[model samples]
Target chain A: MSTTRLARTGGPRPAAAAGRGRSLWRTVRASGWSYAYLAPFVVLTAAFVVYPIFASLGYTFYDWDGIGEPSDFVGLANFKQVATDGYFWRALGNSALYTLVLVPVQLVLALVLALVLNNPRLRGSTFYRALYFLPAITSIAIVGIVLKLMLANFGDAVSKPFLKLGLTDEPLQFLGSPHLSMWTVIAIGIWNTLGYNMIYFLAGLQTIPKDQYEAAQIDGAGRFAQFVHVTIPGLRNVGLVIVFLAIVGSLQVFDLVMVLTGGGPFYSSDVITTYIYREAFGQVGTGVAVEPHIGLASAASFLFGLLLLVVTSGQMLAIRRLRARKEGK
Target chain B: MTELKGARARRGLTHLVLLAIGFAYVYPFLWAVGSSLKTKIDFLDGGLGLLPSRPVWENYAQAWREASFGTYFVNTLVISVTTVAFTLLFTAMAGYALARHTFPGKKIILGVILATYLLPHGYTIVPIYDLINSLGLLNTLTSVILAQVGGGLVFGTFMFMAYFSTLPRELEEAARVDGAGFNTLFFRVMLPVSKPMMATLGLFTFISSWNNFFLPLVFTLGRPELRTVGVGLYAFTNQTTTDWTLLCAGAVISLAPIVVVFVVAQRYIVEAIAGAVKA
Candidate 1:
């Protein structure tokens, strides 16, 4: 890329021309090739990622049935409806609960597991890793089916026995009840992600050199004290990355939730993405199925996308602040 | 006597916890596998044991035949293999570009790739559908392939770039002096030397593509013929809610490729993840 630019600019000092010209021609040739190489990614992203983001914004203002017709430009009406919408609020709340609950619990569990598994004396370490990380790679399709069976109600092979044995009056309608469905979604999300994030924590744990622990030990610090005094502080960046990233990821959650409960017996389990899908594809308005409210769905998606951007940017800013405080330049 | 007693108590407790947790993880898999083998009554019975009295291997055949999964199997295999190969080539090339070249726009390009992953595909599904449909490519294997190639390329590029940034540059420089062009040097020198990175990257790409649930879901749009394994598996269960034996068999069958990859490339995958952590 540079070679082409250099050649286009025409010359250098006369003495260095022969050598530098070859370099310039080479640079120009490489530049042409570089753009050619990079073109496909650029085109795909522009077509797919970049255009969709902008189109989503444009779509938010218009009532267009997904299949056909000229879109009706509805102005800010769709956005206003979302502001007072009950189901929209519930979806937002469920999504928030996932972020607020699942991310923290998952992070803590991951940290503790990483610490335990990072123990140099630990045996069967590889086996433990494979066991734990299996879910990270396991199909969420299969996860949904297995978890559904485990979490089923009456006549369920597993849950029925527990209910029969007087575990509870009735098996908890996990996917049915509005109250439990969100938490169930959150729990599954956490389980799906725990291994991948824990590996990051383990990495962070490894970076806290043996010397720091040795230093603390020499100073008569106990293991727990050393963990608090050194390890927690040491993992700040990794924590920020995992936690912030987890929040963004959890908000984007779709597949397993869709599988476990088609946004539920009620609208209880509805999340932004599921809500978007339902609006676009399912009961659109109030009659048989809801009328396809493409505008409302688009508006909700934009708001949801904005919420993610704000949270991530906030975390990034906090990270910068933390780093500044540490360096104190 | 006291020290020994304390040691034994702690050991017992540790093993007990491991055993309990082990059961939680292992039982689901066993149950899934077990369900595939059982008759409808036994499956419904949900016995504590994984063993099937009859051990019906015919469920596998039935599932394979019933779902028309053989067609989807070919679709999936083609998509995954081709996607992985294309992902491998492009990502490595791009990774090499970003890693070796002190080029303008490198950082910006990397940032764009990373950010693409962050934006949920759920948000982009509509326009991508629109875009694909406009091109009259709806429900084509190419649409699924393109969706994956597009989606998978971002992370694949990022991961490879992360690994490649640390690769030794001395060889590239020497190859340049040997009067080699960029292609020859990359092919003969740097590419050959990036064996470990290529393996792990390929494993990573294949696994993601193999198990990708979403891309094919929306793009397939009810086309039975064009579905990949993941979406095809979904269609199987959705259509036949009662016949879970066949469904579970399909589940096990779909997972076979990934399990094989994991077994073979287990060590490299671990080290690569571990290496990323340290970096």
Candidate 2:
């Protein structure tokens, strides 16, 4: 009887082990289809998105001019060159300045407009929303092109009255003078993207329950008091997000700046992006031939990316701290 | 009575301010359209005046011929359409896989994909440009489309994955119970049901692809004939002495399709942004 029991137990044990093995194989076979679905995205992303990043990182350590293989491994020399470059710092500062001036002004304007448009009693609000949102949809490059042409051609015409009225002796060079170029770009940038933020703020407004405003009204809050107490608090989360997006977006300003200023008049309005473009592709429209520096440009790009990462993380940390404090209170 | 009068006046003042700002906001495009229809002299001398003394309709034809915008338009359409197709196909398949199936290495794959979102897109162009050059695909529409698709996959896949996750489990169970295979379940069952998500993503992809300048510019640097409208227009402006009217006409041509797309799909576009932000 004992011998019989041992035989039976051993028999089931091998069968159970085999069954488990079969099930695992079944799972892997089932997952074969899943991997097939993921293949194209994986392959393309690996080749295009993920690979280029590492490739660029590799390029940053060399001094190659984008032709043939990068042979000269300079070992952080490119990074040092970028760090010491005056033009690099200028470009970085200009980008920071653009974000600083743009975020507050754009957000405040967008919020004010959103409040006006969000009023349920407002007539033709949809029309006004579409009207304001027009520039945001249009291509920034095309917008820059048209504006550049208009300012170049009719700038004198528009400024003629000012000139005649002795507002200024010379015709205002909207894009020519270095002092006015960055401001001009910023003004156009605001106009170009104001509608997007307005829409965002409007969306935020939609999330604020109608009863809260009514509650505030019943508590004897006037219009300004209600805005200060209710709307501001309601918009806090979305406001942080909008601020973050605007800052990041402004820092990456490329197409518009390229079309509008080409970072011209001795790189006065040059953002980091334009600076990188100049290094990678040479001076595009200035009839000047400068050798393309793939290594240097890649180094600059990685450095700028690092800086952006630091800034964004700092912003996130501050936001978290603020939220924690509020919750703690 | 005084309160009612004051309220009416306040409403009127608000309308006035909005109207004025709205006009200033749209005045650039209006000015461009008006200038496109103006004679060279009218355009030069018109000064802030929107209406041309006499509309010159031939400027469009002239700009079309001179800048070869016809070729550029066709190129842009082909590139944009192809990019959207590949993007939708790859992202949808991948998103479905990620959402529905529990597979080995899924977490690692997801981690790798998410890690890419942190990389700033600005500096990577050098390597991408070089990659295209080495592949011997430089100055071709294929290169442009490939780069656009590759660069855009992360966002599309993420969006699609989120969308697919929200779908009911019974969808797959029903398909499987009906003896439907994996491909049939995805293509016939799941993809058809995800029409709204597709539309939202497809429209955005189309708009961005149409307006894209940098990739097209860099990839097609050696071949101007293959340049898209955005790059072509930039090139047009770079001529030493530009015809302002023709430039304006070119701008209008580039802006027309997008403006129409926006006007027609504004509701979807707005809703998509709101939805994305909420998510």
Candidate 3:
């Protein structure tokens, strides 16, 4: 079917002998099939992913309500507004703080879990693995709601233990206090993501051959020394992937924050995505409905997206350089 | 003999530590399930104890009736099923083409997909919203389905590509020599051999679609009847924030399908994650 279509569409061709022409026809036929396979995916991705990316980039340079077309072309005004806006910087800082605190804690805990459970001799390792990973399956939105309730001012779930330990005399408003809210969110972030990260590390751990450890033992190396030498290097790639994912994922944290704090208690816990939400849709209960400013939201997100692209690209470049230097040594 | 005893002791210590950590990890979920059966007063008064002095199963009935979870269930099912079906087929086809064929512009196609892979959903939400609005597809399940599948296709293709690349080329060569067409070769031969990858991709697409919050939230803003379970529970909690018992019941209701899918296909889920990151 496509072979005839290819022949019909052969507008330009290189002059060649009969044998070469046959092979060229064969090449065209093969490409026709490949194009058929690729057509649906390329079309859909262009419609949604590629086109929307450039569309949003174009939106950043204009001032438009979300409903209609961009009438006013305001060059750099929206970008300047977002850059100087106090809330935007605050939200960005909060997101960075969360990532800073959340990534190491999550990675370390997950690595430790994987190391402990990587033992083939351990009984019920599957059960433990499944148990640890249970939270990953639950929707983060539900997790946020449940965590919010558990940490409520009068709720005894989180407060009772702290009270018994005499950590605080009063039942602390974990979600209500501005200072404590972000920390609570960060803690929940680690909890919700711990299992998934552990799975990554576990997969990484499995790929390291047991012979390496045996060789280290033959050389009279201790467990800690072998781990430092062999395990770390073996896991370096997986660790980089995990860390990059954790950073990007935490940077865009929204659903949990939406359901949990709603950037509450004087907007102390607003992250970048939530800030963008407010810019686009306005705050939920601010008496009068604020106008939806799609242009400003697009600008903020565009800047944020650029930052993400640069950070990720930089990370990849750094990793590649490190690997090359290590190989050279 | 002493080394053997020492190794046993170390293993015991490890198990003890793991058990304690695992308990802490899973306790919140257990507590939520326990709280659902308690009365409001009982739950507040019972503190950390998981046992309910009064077991009230009616909470499930009430949450189902009041929250319209039945409607949400069907709505989410339709969205998730259609999205997963389209995502699996489209991505698999793309993956097969990329892996098994040589073509002009192939590098550019792969580059485009990879670029889109790194583009986070946060930046695209506004334009996607505008795109949906312009197309007059807002507030419809189809809009969410289209967006979700498009978003998922890249990673799915990545996974399938990795899997397909590892397969030996001889089988395909033999089939091609026997006059098998491309479609027949893929569906009859390659698809059967690629079951594990398909399972991994399908489970992932299903779970993410089922648990998806942002797209569904933004798309179906005012359409309560068309809300997915995630958004339905969110709305329920917003309306009844203090009713812990009812909220827990609603949470349990929403979690059931995903929990079942996870328990059934958990190995593939983990493999999918591992393969995705590695690929």
Top TM-score prediction, candidate number: 2
| Fnat scores for every prediction | 0.25, 0.59, 0.61
Chain A superposition TM-score per model: 0.86, 0.90, 0.88
Q: What does DockQ come to for candidate 1?
A: 0.41
Better of 1 and 3 by DockQ: 3
Candidate 3 runs further than 4 Å off: A1-31, A153-157, A285-288, B1-6, B118-122, B240-242
CA-based DockQ, model 3 = 0.55
Tell me each candidate's TM-score: 0.89, 0.94, 0.92
What is the per-candidate TM-score for chain B? 0.88, 0.97, 0.90
lDDT of 2 at A65: 82
* lDDT digits (tens) for residues A1-329 of candidate 2: 22223222423322466588775566567678788989989988998888877788898888988778899999999999999999999999999999999989999999999999998888999889999999998888888998988888778876788899998999999899898899899989988999889989999999999999899999999999999999999888888878888988999999989999999777999999999999989988779888888889999999887877776777678789878989999
**Which regions of candidate 1 fall more than 4 Å away from where they truly are?**
A1-30, A153-167, A283-291, B1-5, B102-122, B162-165, B274-279
> Across residues B13-105, which tens digit of lDDT does each residue of candidate 1 receive?
765676677667656677778888999888766555577888998898887787776777788899888888887887777776666654445
State the lDDT of candidate 1 residue by residue for A107-172, as single tens digits.
888887888778776677667777777777767765676666546622244456668889767666
lDDT per residue for candidate 3 within A1-329, as digits (tens), equals 34324334544444577677676767766677789988989988888888887888888888887766788899999999998999999999999999999999999999998998888899989889888998888789887787777777245556778999999888778889898888888998999988889999999998899999999999999989999999999998888888988998899899888988888778899999999998887675334376778889999988898888877887788789878988899
How big is the positional error of residue A174 in model 1, measured in Å on the Cα after superposition?
A: 2.4
Q: In terms of TM-score, how similar is model 3 to the real structure?
A: 0.92
Model 2 agreement with the true structure over B21-82: per-residue lDDT tens digits: 99989999999999999997887679778999988999999888877888888999999999
Q: Report the C-alpha displacement of residue B233, candidate 3, in angstroms.
A: 0.9
